[model samples]
Target: MSGSGSRTAAARAAVGAVWSSVTSACWRHWPTWAGWAAGGFSLLYGLLGLYWTAGGDGFPFAPVDPARASGSILEGSRVEVVAPIIAVLGLVGAVVAWLMTRRARPGRRSAAALMVFGWAAAIGLTVIVPDYTLIILVAFAPLLLVFAFTGVPGDQGGIGDILYWHRTNLIIVFVGGLLWATATLAYRRRARGACASCGRRHEEGGGPSRQTLLRWGRWAVAVACLAPLPYEITRIAWYLGHPLGVTPDFLRMMQDTPGMLEVGLGCALASALGGVLTHGLVARWGETYPRWIWFKAGRRVPPTLAIVPASIVAVTIIPAGLMFLWTSEARGTWAMYVPSLFWTVWGVALGVATIAYHLRRRGACRHCGQGPQPGPEPRTSLDQRQVRDDPVSAPGQRA
Candidate 1:
């Protein structure tokens, strides 16, 4: 029995060693793995899309009807022919990314080129196959439920329908813009070790009072985030048969789609959670991870992680709000105008808040090693009196 137990222990130790070695190797070469995986997937999907398109059977890309205004751009010709070209580009990107990973550190030119091409492919794919693209705003399904329950004639019927309409080329433009901004920042960081915008390191300065701006900005963001909660709540109540903002007929229709209620509740909860997260922008937690997050606690937050998403949300909301205004006026639903107006305000406020947060936390110059300079000391009452009395000593004294 002792001999058998010793053999089992040895086997377990060998297995553990092997697993650790494999994991370590994978961790060290993650960029190569990611690049290969992305390349393979893109190539496969593009080929499949092209093959199906040639067969006269629409298996991948959505069939476009020549009659519709939106479909006209893709009608009569296989516009999806670009899929294979994009896939080839993706493969090239993969090679570049792999090369970058192999080097001690990726060069700025290589990284920038890879980022530009990768983002272009991603945006192009999204634009070409929007129906297959996952919608981030699906979380707002509950809010849409509210409109549906209220028997709003302009309500686009279901969340899916709304997403179909919302995922336009405009989204691609915004995402591309964000990708450019992030790539520029990454390149600057890797190349110069200085702030991308200011050229100098961000350091604490006594130049101006930003406390009031930050305080007000945080509150504004919180309010803006929570603004959609009322609609969400009413929608949830309607789902539960309380019928707050809904008609009896609408309630009956809602009962047919019981799952929608759960979805709406989830969205409402998510929105509330988002409101809570907005506070992190101005709070200490934004600068450093909270204690509850054990692994990353006290670690400084990556600025791009917060700024990119916030900026994207802000940009998307502005156009969406404008669209809402136009649609509401055309449909004569004056009440809908309020949400549109508020959405624009929210977008602007969130953008300002994000900028404020960045300004507050941006580090001092890594290049010149310059930090915030001390302001000149203010004169006290006694010092002011003495200076006034001693004129020769105060100004241009001839010694």
Candidate 2:
């Protein structure tokens, strides 16, 4: 009778837990509404952009004066027909993801669809508008917001709960944004410095060095924190130079050229650094300062903080690296046909780093006895006399 009663109690406890989880996940109103709104906007923009960029005869929606356009849409005389179209597709994906957030309601099907649609848009944008990665960047913006607000799989509490639940997912989105933005920035700077009219490259002291690689790593972290700043600056600078139509030729040339070299190196370095940051710092540091540090006290750090940032890096850098190969090529028939080989190599490196980072973070050391062990057995504290009496037994033996 007692055993049967205990079983019934355990069953009730399990059912209660599931019920709580369902309730937490289901509680919603605002997120659903915002998602629908964003999704709708995405669909509308995608159609307009695609129509103009792909279907229009020359430059779609060419306006005499863009600043004084009718209706809510901002008027622009010139638009990159192909690039803008690709961006519109990405926006469409974002809308789909938003709709999925509410409609699918955070189940396996919903998350999976979100990921698939997001990737499809990203790949399509990459192929159509290789030089302009902003579309891909825009696609992730809404997804990141979703991640920040959503609940994690194992999370079993309300908004005010101890764990932020989706913190790790948020970090991953951030890292992905950082890498893509860094790469974009680097491409921009390279274009500026390599402008044909400005100067020619010196043969000496040109190849990448160790210090250069280190700087690239720093660029990754900095850019991750302040994503899109470089792009905005470049855009602003371009606008300033084109004022009053005094230098149409010069503006056209500048726009045609790629970005600065520093930004490119920064992108590459950030890509590499993201791998290290996610896997190395989070996995090994776990509240413990570096061994070489002067301070000797042992400390405990929050696991989530360490895990999330690095996980984000691991997830994003690999994809960004792969995309970089074809996207980096100068526009031409030959450049278009060339395979994305270098980017693929870098992606492999990033993947390895990501895996290693997680492994180390999870305490999977052979010498440390930190990996998963046998069943949970009761532990007892003993006095000095008992320890002396037992001395030491075999590895599996109990006291």
Candidate 3:
């Protein structure tokens, strides 16, 4: 009993220690990113917006005919109306972002206003304006490079032809939206009187506790795991010689296309792998390397190893799903795009799960000298000793 308890205690302590240290292993990290991305970038982009308002040529949001417009809300927006709005918002956003990141925290109402605007801009640029075009570009970028070497079967427009200035303009806008969103989070941490970097308070109540996040994250992980299953199923069916959603005539056409089965198999394998990796969000192996791994076994996994790729995939999924739903070649055909019904749900859930994973493992704030919140498990030698002596409690609670 004592031996088993000792091992349990060791594992628990090790997990806590490694999680706590994650914050320290960094590359000249900022206290909270300080809204620089939001403020500075907004200021620069706003100037461009003003230029576009004048007579600048590259205004990406010029009004399009409604029927031709895909799902993007920005379609049919006049340059005269759009440019000035972007200019004003960009100018105003710079000021708001600056105030948000200041050392002196703003009043409750002021902070609330800042957060509202920041989040609104984030959603507008990220979800409302952009369409599935971005999704196709990102997903097929690698393929384009490959095609560059082997040469596509048909006329392959190089990257420049496909990713014209218009699409690139939208990409830049998406990046701006991300900056504002992050700025909002940093501002919230500072305004709450917590450590800006880690958001840990000297006393409790900086925000939701670790336990709360864990509970919420579990649901998010479940949703994420399931969301991609539909897409995977459809692809797998095609690979197995039984096209699930496509009609026989359509399937024949697709089969006639070169590398059709290969492409379907590739997509299936990718989604399947993505789902499995997402499962690690709440698994023990996510916290530390398992014994099966060679040299690095038993060591704490670097948080970035899981976070970076997960973030990229999640970001890509959202717009692609939106595009499929709103306007695509599959508009009349249910079989082509029906499986993507839950893609947005998957992307959202994955994002939430990633946030929860960060919160759970990011030990304490080095700047403020905070630490992991106390767990229900026994801590001290005396506490462990007592539990060991008492057979009923010797096992203690799971970490």
Q: What are the TM-scores, per candidate, against the unseen true structure?
A: 0.46, 0.32, 0.77
Off by over 4 Å in 1: 1-168, 176-196, 199-210, 295-299, 328-341, 365-399
Off by over 4 Å in 2: 1-41, 47-95, 103-115, 122-283, 294-297, 301-324, 327-343, 348-399
lDDT per residue as tens, model 3, 1-399: 999999999999999989778755532255446487778878887888899899898777665444334455565568898888888988998998888778886899988999999899888777666766666666678887887777655554556555565667778777888888777877888889876667777788546665677677778999999888877887787767786777877777777888887787787787888788887877656755666786665566788888887787777678767766656567555657877767788889999999888876676565776876534433335344334422332365535
The better candidate by lDDT, 1 or 2, is 1
Predict model 3's lDDT versus the native: 0.74
- Local lDDT at 240 for model 1: 74
For model 1, the local distance difference test gives: 0.52
Q: Arrange candidates by TM-score, highest first: which order?
A: 3, 1, 2
lDDT of model 3 at residue 28? 24
Q: Where does candidate 3 stray beyond 4 Å?
A: 1-34, 63-71, 133-154, 205-215, 241-243, 373-399
Displacement of the residue 289 alpha carbon in candidate 2, Å: 2.5
